[model samples]
Target chain A: MHLLEIQNLTKIYEGKKVLDDIDLHLKKGTTLGLIGPTGCGKTTLLRIIDLLDLPSSGKIFFDGIDITASNVKDMDIRRRIGMVFQKPIVFKGTVYDNIRYGLKVRGKNEDSYETEIFKLLDSLGLAGYEERDASTLSGGETQRIALARVLITEPDLLLLDEPTANLDPLSTEKIEKLIAELSKKKHTTIIMATHNLIQGQKLSDQIAILNKKIFQMGTPEEVFLKPAHKFVAEFVGVRNVKKGTATQLEPDLTLIKLRKINIYSISHLEGLVYASIRPEDITLSKMKVISSALNEFKGNVKGIVDNGGLIEIEVDVGEDFTVHMTRKSFLDMELTVGSEVWLQFKASAVNVFECEC
Target chain B: MSEIINAFFQAINLIVSLDPEVIEITLRTMFISLSSTFFAALIAIPLASLIHFNKFRGKRSVMNVIQTLYSLPTVLVGLLVFLLISKSGPLGNLSLLFTPGGMILGQTILVIPTVIGFSIIGLRGVKEEIKELALSLGASNLQTVTTIMGEAKYALLGAIILGFGRAISEVGVALMIGGNIRGYTRVITTTMSLETQKGNVELSIALGIILLSIALIVNLILNQVQER
Candidate 1:
């Protein structure tokens, strides 16, 4: 059975629907990365699942028990689930007291958890800092302390709402590594809402794209490689989107017409259509390659951008198309502005969707 | 100016000499004000916490009413308490009129609104994030209240001190309710009024000095608490 299931959850705030019919399920010991733009109801979803607020409709089940029921003791459910808010909230006391507050309130003997608490502190690079004042700590230190406070309780399910949103790079790395280790070693279920797409892709075992609703839900590969919606395509950084008209070329083949160009894709989408392809899929070559790939166009390398480990080359066949490749590939091809190149990708690489507007 | 200086000197001499009447009045004043402040705090802290943390219909209007009552005239409060404890009044059986108890009661009523008003502001001053953080950590409603109260400790203390300051310095309630009975119900404010009326400016100036000193101390502490 799924450890957590949100069935048709809807949340309306002040007569405005912030979350509309969001349905999701997560197995035990897995991290579900919730990625969305701001005001997309990521925090609201987490708040409802954490039992901080009641849903307008639908039910949330935890371990097959309906936790959203009015009769369920919320304290019992809340004790088993921990949440880290976006802003770090350290109680008014020493770091030691802040970290121990959760365990203390849950009726755990503080003395017995001394070693465990210290171990958590050390793991988070907070050793020897227990006696320091929590309020006096820096932002990164405060967030680390907040996480330690929640983690010490050993909650069954941990909910993080952009836990590392405002941390320094070192702190972000530390928190990400800590989360990874915790999930792997302790098998703690985690649901993290984050705007950092790269961090979401890196940390989450399963990804759910929430934008007033569940736009997409799948593995990182599936969501990034084959987005089912235009919002997901744009959010996932697939930038080569073009509006075109698709017609049946033959059995199991669809042809889309663009201004001054025609591209073949494998889709049943007809009439007005929108097609997107990831920048990485298109290969840029200095010479024409003889291949069975049906979508090949000769264009100039209009712009060459050095993006750290990789290079983004904008090739303009009829319209500007971005192609990503390693810096080594760019150097090997001797690519520069106005350099003639052939952009090639298989027909299956184009993801066509029915245009809604 | 000379007369005023002479009165100031005479007042200081009276205080320095530890006159039994002045000592009794000062102590009684402290007792009455402190008791009123204590009772006010006992009622105000929890009431303000409720208003601060919970949302209910008419909450804003209730808060506005409390705020308006902060400026309630002490004479009006004194009249209200006097009528309640008068011989033909509802609480007449208590026989608290013209005594220290009556003064304390009137002072308590006089300070309660300010106490509650300032306390609500102080408690509300606690960051919303702090309260939410505590609740999200699985804390019970009571535990969260404790945490919030703990966070607003300084401001709440300031509120108490402010109420005590207001109670100790005001004369209308104590005059009307305590009747300023010498050696029994007399306090700093009432004593100052009586001495000044009797043309004894020296004693009046001495009591004024003491009252001003108390106000100064309260304000200093208030500034320090707020700054903290």
Candidate 2:
């Protein structure tokens, strides 16, 4: 049975619809990642699920009971769920007190969780920090403590809003590891909202691309590699999105025509469509090489940006195409502004998705 | 100038010697001011939290009026209280006129607005995220408020201390209501006013030094809490 279900949830703030007609379901002990751009109602959806804010319409069923009524006073319902905000909240006290707050509110004595608290502190790399003031800790340490505070209660559902958005790389890795462990060992269901695509793929069993509503929902591989819609393709870092009309060129190949560029894909999508290719998929070479790849064009490098170890080149071959390559490749080819290059990719590399207006 | 300098040394002597009259006046001043601040806090903190955490019609206008009353003159509050407790007034039958109780009543009225104003600011100053964090952690409604009050305890304490400072430093309310009775209702501010008027600069200076010391202590504590 699904542990939680949200049906037709809509939230209107000041008569402006923020979340419109959204539906979702989560099985027990599974992680659902909510991914979207900023101001895309991801936080609002999490707030409603955690019961911190009520939805303007629709029902949320938790454990087979509808709990979306505004006057629901069951503390037990809230007690079974934990939510961590985007900004870490550290009350005026020592680390021990902040971690013990959840238990304290439930009328549990400090002695009851002393051993467990110490174990969590040690595991979170906060040993000997029980006496340290929470306010004096670094941002990463504070976020860790906030997570510890919520997790110590053994909540059934955990809601995290960008828990590692601003942390150092080490802290982010530690938090991600802890989240995976929680779901595996404690059987805690989690819904994490993040804008980082790689992090969402790494931490979530199911990914929901949300923008005012769920645009697409599937496994990480399905959502990232085979986006079902143009919005998802664009949002998932597919840099080259071309509006074109597709014509069946063969039994297995379809030709997509842009204003001045022609591309071929293995998918037999017809009519008006969008063909998307990730930047790293398009290989740039100084010479046009004979290959089995169906799409190849000689283009001029219009712009070049050194993105740390990688080079991002915008080539104009009847159309603008952004391509990413390693610094070694760019230096070997001596690629720079106005450099002539050949762009080549396989027909399978292009994903044809219809635009959802 | 020399007289003033001499009075400064005399004021130290008075404080060190613990003169009975000075001690009595100081104790009465603390008693009245402490009572007024206590009563004001008893009413103001919860009221401020309620007004701050809830939404209602006219809430902005109500807060504006309260903020305006934060600076209402002590003498004006004293005058308003005096009329209510005077003979032929509606509350005259209580026999609180010309007594410390009357002075406390007037000071409480004067300090309540300030306490509320500061409490609202202190509570509002806490990030909105904290409250949501508390509720998300399974805190009951009362527990959420207790958590907020704990987070803002220093600011709340600062508000009470500020109210005490304002009450103990004002003379108009104490003079008009307490009648400045020598052994009955005389407090520091009223007695200081009387001594200064009588040209007994030494006693007035002693009282002034004690008052300023109290104000300094309160503000020092307030500043310390604010820094944290």
Candidate 3:
């Protein structure tokens, strides 16, 4: 069953539309990753879902009940949802008092909850720091405390907005692991906004790429393998793309034409097209080699960019094309700034998209 | 030179001896000033918070009125309160003309605007992101306000101290409204004025020393509290 649903959500500020006709749905116990560029309404969407901002016009249903226009008194819906902001805000008090703020506001002062609070703190690596001043904590420590503060409430849905944007790599890894473990243990539904695509792929069960609109939404594997729009394909780091008109020849084979170049694809697409190939799918050879691959282009290495473990080699095959290969391959081929090479890839590796021109 | 030395030694002797009349006047001064400052803070802090946090029509006009009131002369406030409490005035039936309550009323009117103006400046200086974070945590409007107050507690305390210091040292309002009645409303400043007019340097110097000591103690306590 759908746990939350938003329909036709629109928000306008100062005669400009910030959010335009956004629709989304979430299922129970699933993590949804919201991926977008900066200023792409991701945080605004989270704010609307948390009921911090009223939509210009929309219907929001949580637990099969419409909660639009509800006031703070009618906040049973809010009780079931908790949000962690991008920057951790620790009140001016001891860490224990900061965590106890929400509970105290709700008129709960039982000492029995302290045990659970301690356990949560321990799990988030904040043990023995309850009585410490909140202002003395580091950025990562504060983020953990913020998460621990919300998780102790045991809300059914947890919303985190860029929770690890400011953390070091080790802290980021720890937080990602803690999130995964919490989901498995409590069946908690999580909605997180992230600019890190690799982290999104590792942590989220479902991914939604939001541009000016909902560019695509599906399971991480489904969205990564079959992006419905060119924006989503590029956002997920699928780099080698050629804009063309696509004709479906069969269930597996298609034809794409760009200017004077006609390319055949074993993937089917119809109408105006974007033929995308993951950079890793193409192989670079220093010399001509025989291969069963149907598409092989002789090109010159226009540029080589070293990005951590992989080398991104831009090949000019009578047209601009990008090919990503391992650092080992570049070193073995002795590829340099002006190296000549043959780029080979199977037709089946091309992802075809049919959308408006 | 001998008379000046006599006055100074006798002033110290009066304080050490805790002379009844001098003690009574000093105690009355402390009571009136502290009570008025406390009452002003109680009314001003929440009013300032409201004005700082919410948007409303006529807000600029309201702020302008507050800013104008903030610099209102102590003598002017004394005259205004004096008219209201005088026998032929609007509140004549209450008979508060020469009482400590009348002095307190005048001082409260004088100090309230100072407290409110500084409190508004303090609360307004807190970052907007902190408020948004509290709101996103599903805190109600009251909770948000409380959080902001907690965050700005140091600034608010400083404002209260400033108002208290101003109220305690203000002699114009206290002298005008209380009328310096002996054993009833004769406070430190009024007594000092009367003693000096009669050329009695010992009692006048004693009262002056008490007032300066009280002001110094208040300032020291404020500094210590702020340091913490």
Candidate 4:
């Protein structure tokens, strides 16, 4: 059974629909990374799931109990789950007091939790800093303190809204490591919302793409490698999007026509469509090679970009298509600007969706 | 000018010598006003929280009314309390008229509006996210209220201090409600008023200095609290 379920959750803020009929489900011990742009209602959805805000129309079930029911005691359910807000919100007190606040509020004996609080502090790399004023700390320190305060609660479910948005690299690593540890516990379910695509993919077992609702949700590989729509593809870094007209072919093949080129993809989509392929999915070679990749285009590398560990080579094959590859591969192939190259990808690599051109 | 200058010198001498009557009046005034402020804050803070947390019709108008009453006439409050505790009045059987308790009652009524008005503004100034943050951490509705209240503690204390200032400095309630009885109910303001009226200008000036000093001390604390 799913540990948490949201059915048709719609939230309207001041006469505008912030979240539009979002449906989501999470099993026990699953870390679902919620990714979206700003103002996409990530915080709003978290608020509703945390039971801190009511949805305009929806039903949320936690532990097989409908939490959105009028008779349900929200505090009882909210106590079982905990949320760390996007901001590093700390009370006006010592770090010790801030970390122990959740325990104290839930009626736990403070003296008994003193050892636990210190242990949490040590794990957060904030040992010996418990005596410091929480409000006086830097942004990174405050974020760690915020995480420590919530992690100490041992909530059955956790909601983190952009947990690593504004932190430095070191603090981000620490928080990410902590979240990874929590994900492996197998007793704590986490739903973390983040705008960092790489971080979300690395830290979450499942990923949900959202705009006003759940656009697509699956394993990181499924969502990124094979997006369900144009928005999901573009958001997940599929930059080879081209509007084309597709005609259905037998044996589950769809022939699409781009400007002055014909490409075949294994999809049922026909008519005016949007076809996208991940940059890395297209193999770039110096010469035409016969292989399983049926869609081959001969073009010149118009631009070469060094992206840290990787390289992005833009090829102009009638339409400029960006291809991603390792720097080592680019160096080995001696790929440079204005170099002739052949782009090849399998028919299945092209994700075709029926949408307005 | 020479007579007023002599009175100023005499007033400084009285203040330096720490006149017993002046000290007694100052102590009595401080006790009654502080007690009234304490009791009034005990009532007004929670009342202000209730108003802030709940959505009710006419809430803005209610706040407007409270803010308007912040400068309510001291004699009007005195007359209202006088009516309640006067002989043959509703609460007359307690014989509280002309007593320190009656004076505290009148002062409390006079200053409740100040505390409530200031507290409402303070609570409103607290960020909305603080309450939501607390609630997300498993806090019940009441616990969240306390969290917000703690966030605005400085402002709330300032409210009480302002109320205490109002209670201590007002003369009409002290005079009309307590009758300014000698030694029993005489306070700084009523005694200062009486002394000035009886041509004992030097004593009144000395008491006025004491009142100014008290206000200065209160203002200093307010500055410290707000700076934090």
- Stretches of candidate 2 off by over 4 Å are A12-17, A74-76, A238-352, A355-357, B1-12, B71-76, B79-83, B86-93, B196-199
Off by over 4 Å in 3: A70-76, A284-292, A299-308, A326-342, B226-228
DockQ of 4: 0.69
**Candidate 1 lDDT, tens digit per residue, A1-357?**
689998999999999999999899999999999999999999999999888888999989998889988888888888999999888878888999999988877878899999988998898998999999888999999989999999998888999999899789999999999999989999999999999899999999999998999999999998988787889889888889888999988877899997778999999889988888788889888889998789999999889788797788889999789999997888888987999999998899899987777
Q: Looking at model 4 chain A, report the run of 10 residues with the lowest lDDT sum.
A: A348-357
Best by DockQ: 4
Instruction: List ranges where model 1 is wrong by over 4 Å.
Output: A242-277, A290-295, A299-303, A306-309, A316-320, A325-340, A347-357, B1-3, B54-57
- TM-score of the second chain, each candidate in turn, equals 0.96, 0.95, 0.92, 0.98
Q: After superposition, how far is residue A247 of candidate 1 from its true place, in Å?
A: 8.0
Per-residue alpha-carbon lDDT of model 2 for B129-227, expressed as tens digits?
788888889999889988888888888888888888889899889988889999889999888888999988889989889999999988898899888
Please, what are the lDDT tens digits per residue for candidate 3 over residues A98-175?
787667656676477899888878887788999999989999989988888788677788998998997998778778
DockQ of each: 0.62, 0.65, 0.44, 0.69
Candidate 4 Cα outliers beyond 4 Å, as residue runs: A243-259, A266-274, A301-303, A306-311, A325-340, A352-357, B1-18
Model 2: per-residue lDDT, tens digit, A194-286? Answer: 999999999899999999989999999999988888788879877788889999989999999999989999988888988888888999999
Q: What's the TM-score of every candidate structure?
A: 0.89, 0.83, 0.92, 0.92
Candidate 4 whole-model C-alpha lDDT, 0 to 1? 0.90
Better of 1 and 3 by DockQ: 1
Give each candidate's fraction of reference contacts reproduced: 0.68, 0.92, 0.30, 0.70
